[model samples]
Target: MHYVKSKSILSAKNGMNLYRGCTHGCIYCDSRSKIYNMNHEFEDVEVKENALELLKKELIKRPKAMIGTGAMTDPYIPAEKHLKFVRNSLELIYRYGFGFTCITKSDLVLRDLDLLEKINEKSKVVVQMTLTTADDELCSILEPNVCPTSRRFEVLKMLDEAGIATVVWLCPILPYINDTEENINSILDYCIEANVHGVLCFGMGLTLRDGNREYFYEKLDEHFPGLKARYIKEFGNDYSIPSHDEKRLMEIFKYRTSKAGILNDTNEIMSYLSEFPQKSVQSKLF
Candidate 1:
């Protein structure tokens, strides 16, 4: 890991990535795509040394809104166990009376449950987790460096019991690998049991671009020999490789989420994540 001074923190939308690159080793990571243009290795992990200071300053100046992270890199990556950047950022968000949300694949997020709960009470906090495959073995193969789906389910349950809202990103389902009725159903069952507020699924297939495409094909060759050749034959260099089963899989997704009363519309979920709580507004007014 290396630290670099950051000129600023929050995005125009109040999102910030305190770290760059990742060590999660997820084979389908889009962050590795060349379009992002990272000068360092994907595993090197560039730390924004002044992120917390900048965040505190920005929080004081900007009108209250939800502060988000973990978009480009998982904030709870293994490095977080020692660095505590995410945890410190959470403290600032809570202290400054801003809502918070993040997308992560690590159970390490549970370490900051106390602060998350506090933020929830004061404003709002939504914990969004990505669950692509329900099978633990496949999860290991797809997201090797992160916690398994079973453990993530437990984390979701814990968050539910703590009165924190949760959301799941069930996506990037690799075709001919995990794109199956059984796999989708199993993950949906977990979302139902966890009482997640929503499930965001763009489609049943994953996107492969320049940098990530080569890396994904290499991993496919290593683990599922001959798969890369099949991908090239089938997909060529297309960006969006929709699953042959996309229509059927999306039907299932809509059916399950609708029946469970969870928000399935992408626009609706994004709105929920950005909306600050009415209670927070009233408290501030008084």
Candidate 2:
């Protein structure tokens, strides 16, 4: 891990990543793709030393606060164990009494549960977790070296039981990998049982680009020989890689989430996520 000054902290949409690379080593990470132009090794991890200071300034000056992170890289990577950068940012967010949201697969986030609960209590905080496959063995192969699917499910359950509203990213279900109806149904079943607030599904598939496409294809060759060739022939530089059974799977996804009252539309999910602040607290008080 190395520290460098950042020009800016938050994006126009109010998102910020304190780190630039991930250590989770997920074989299919799109952040590793060349389109991102990350100059360092995918695992080298560039730390934004001044990000906290910048964020503090932004938070103080902004008219409203709804900070999000973990888009380009996972905030709670192994490097986070020592850097504490994310923790520092969280402290700042809470100090300012700002709403917070994070997308991560690491159970390390549980370490910040106390702070998260406090943020949720004082303002708003949402934790988003991605669940691709319910099968543990398959999970290890696709998202190897991170917490298993069961552990992630437990995280969702724990968060829900704590009254911490949660959203599940039921996405990137790789074709010929985990796109089966059974896999999708099992994950959706768990999401429903966990009583999550919403589930985001983008038509039951993954995206591949210059860097990410090559990496994903290589992994495909390593794990499922001939599958990479299939993808190459079907998707030729195209970004969207929908499953062959996408229509049926999407139907199930929509039906199951709708029945559970979980938000499923991408626009609706983003609208809900990007919502600046909820008036529920003030309304409840009134």
Candidate 3:
């Protein structure tokens, strides 16, 4: 882990990434894409040393709106356990009466359940977790360092019980590996059981850019021999790699989420994430 002072903390849309790199070791991380221009090694986590002070300043100036994190990097990475950056930032957001939302693949989020509940009471808190595969064994291979999908499902249920809204990012569906109907159904079952507010899936396949494509193919060679060659043959320098079963699996995704009454529309879910409870702002004003 290393530290660097960032010029700014929050994006135009109020998103803040406390860290620059990652360590969860997910095989298909798009953050590794060359466009982000991450100068350090992907696993070498970069800490924004002045993020908290900067966040507090920005929050004070801005109107009540949802502050998002973990868009480029998961805020709950192992470093958070000791650094307490995420937990501290949550306290700041709560202190300033601002809303909070984050996307993560770790159960370490459970540690700050109290802050999340507190923020929800003041404004709103939406926690989004990525669940790619239903099988814990497959999850271990795909995600590697973090907790499995089953544990993430448990976290979602706990968040729901606390009355905090939750969303699931069911994505990066590897072509032949996890693009099966059964995998989609099993993951959707977990979402329904957890009572998530929505499930966001852009398509049935992962996007591979220059940097990530090389890394993903390397991992494929390590685990699934000859799979890299297969991917190269099937998708030659293509950015969007759609699965052969995209249509069928999407049908299952829509049917299951619709039956469960979960939000399936990406636009609606994003609006929900960015929307602040006006009542919370009004309460603070008066």
**Which of the numbered candidates is closest to the native, going by highest lDDT?**
1
Deviation (Å) of 50 in candidate 3: 0.8
TM-score quality measure for candidate 3: 0.97
Question: lDDT per residue, candidate 2, 64-143, as tens digits?
Answer: 66799988888888888887888888899989878889999989889888989888888788899989999999889888
Task: TM-score for candidate 1, please give it.
Answer: 0.97
The residue-by-residue lDDT of candidate 3 on 185-283, one tens digit each, is: 999999999999999999999999989999999999999999999999989999999999899899999988998999999999998899888872334
* Each prediction's RMSD to truth: 1.9, 2.4, 2.1
Tens digit per residue, CA lDDT, model 1, 195-284: 999999999999999999999998999889998898999999999998999999999999999999999999999999999877623445
* Per-residue lDDT of 281 in model 3: 38
- Tell me how far the alpha carbon of residue 50 in candidate 1 is from the true structure, in angstroms, after superposition: 1.1
Off by over 4 Å in 3: 280-286
How much is the lDDT of residue 204 in candidate 3?
A: 98
